[model samples]
Target: MKLSSLQAIPRCFHTTRWSLVRQATADDSAEALDAMETLCEAYWYPLYAFIRRSGYSPEDAEDLTQGFFARMLDRDILTTADPGRGKLRTFLLTCLRRFLAHETERRMAQKRGAGLIVSMDTTWAENRYLHEPVDHLTPDRLYQRRWALTVLEHTLRLLKDEYEDKGKGVLFEHLRPYLGLGVEPEQSYEAMAAKLGQSLTNTKTQVFRLRQRWRELLFEQVSMTLDDPSSEEIKAELSELMQCL
Candidate 1:
């Protein structure tokens, strides 16, 4: 579901992600293949970060993440998934964990683009992977945190596009700090207000709207990962996203 539709059901959640899963598991389905490929492109970083935290070098992590998706898509292994028992997040991680433990027997370098499921920028992926925080988080926790972050990043990008499309790009830039990714403005809100030709109160109101929209986006993003998340589950996921920040 799109973020724009989120406000219509403020206290409810629905997701089209299950259809992505269902189609992705059908035999000889191009739609399924496309769905899986899109998901791989969007989510490969979390799997790579999980691998890196498990002591793989950046190069190895890149190879394995690439190779894993290659095998998964080529073999259509997701067809074996049981919709009754698996959430997409758990299913993907379960497959990755198995791939890492027992399925790296193939030549990693050779498998890099073998299936051609998705084109990954290994150079970009490696450079970005290297900058991940060095901390005491276990690999599983790291995976969860990265998953949460990817969701936020996606939401922010969409939000930016929405503002730009509405001719509010400059306002979004100035009010961005109040969206609370811990961004500190180079200048105070008073300065930002003067520069934007908006009163300080108006600036605060715009930021409030941005933040409200952001929370809705976050809820929608997290809810998409689960099959049928309740209000409590969504709230818990929201809390986890906050903690990850």
Candidate 2:
């Protein structure tokens, strides 16, 4: 789920960076909510994959997945998730492990998510589930891949939205080719520029801006989930995640 595409959903709807929120106006609060919802919608699939990888049945996985976010709000988890001690991927894995360890219910499939269900659209989620590669991975490997993918997806959304907000939609899409680079053969920047109808200079600028937004946004996304204020070592950790992607 590209948060860049979630223009349809207002950020005022979800409980996002509320821990850091100090906005006084109603409009600002609404935008924050929308971002929170976008974050939730963007991440559910990767979280679901991790739940399934943890040896839960499909129904169990789905419920546990639902419950995790429920706790994110109902337990004030998001508001106090800590801004420092670890990576968002690490934080999510730890949280998931703890949730799975303590959650002792069987599949009560009908008792699903409560009112916190995100209203964001999701042809992407459906397609992702239908086509996700599930073979050759033990539960552990799957969990790792889920972590990687989740961070990557979140970073993509952040970049996309930054571009859109700056009125560079075409330029944003042009930069996406770099994302799935390994999925396709590598190409020269000249080719990329020509394909996007951009000059070499504009292409370089796009890549530079993309990298900047990605790093800053990546830091924000990952560190905000830590157990401590990771103000000190957060950049190193983010650089590592970026290297993986």
Best-fitting candidate, scored by TM-score: 1
Residue 181 Cα positional deviation in candidate 1, in Å, after optimal superposition: 1.1
- Model 1: residue 177 alpha-carbon error in angstroms: 0.2
lDDT of 2 by residue, 160-211 (tens): 8877888987777757665543255446889987887879898888676566
Q: After superposition, how far is residue 83 of candidate 1 from its true place, in Å?
A: 4.6
Worst 10 residues of 1 by lDDT: 1-10
Shift of residue 70 alpha carbon in model 1, Å: 2.8
Q: Candidate 1, which segments miss by more than 4 Å at Cα?
A: 1-14, 27-34, 79-86, 104-111, 185-191
Off by over 4 Å in 2: 1-39, 71-84, 87-91, 105-110, 113-127, 165-167, 178-203, 227-232, 239-245
**Per-model lDDT:** 0.72, 0.58
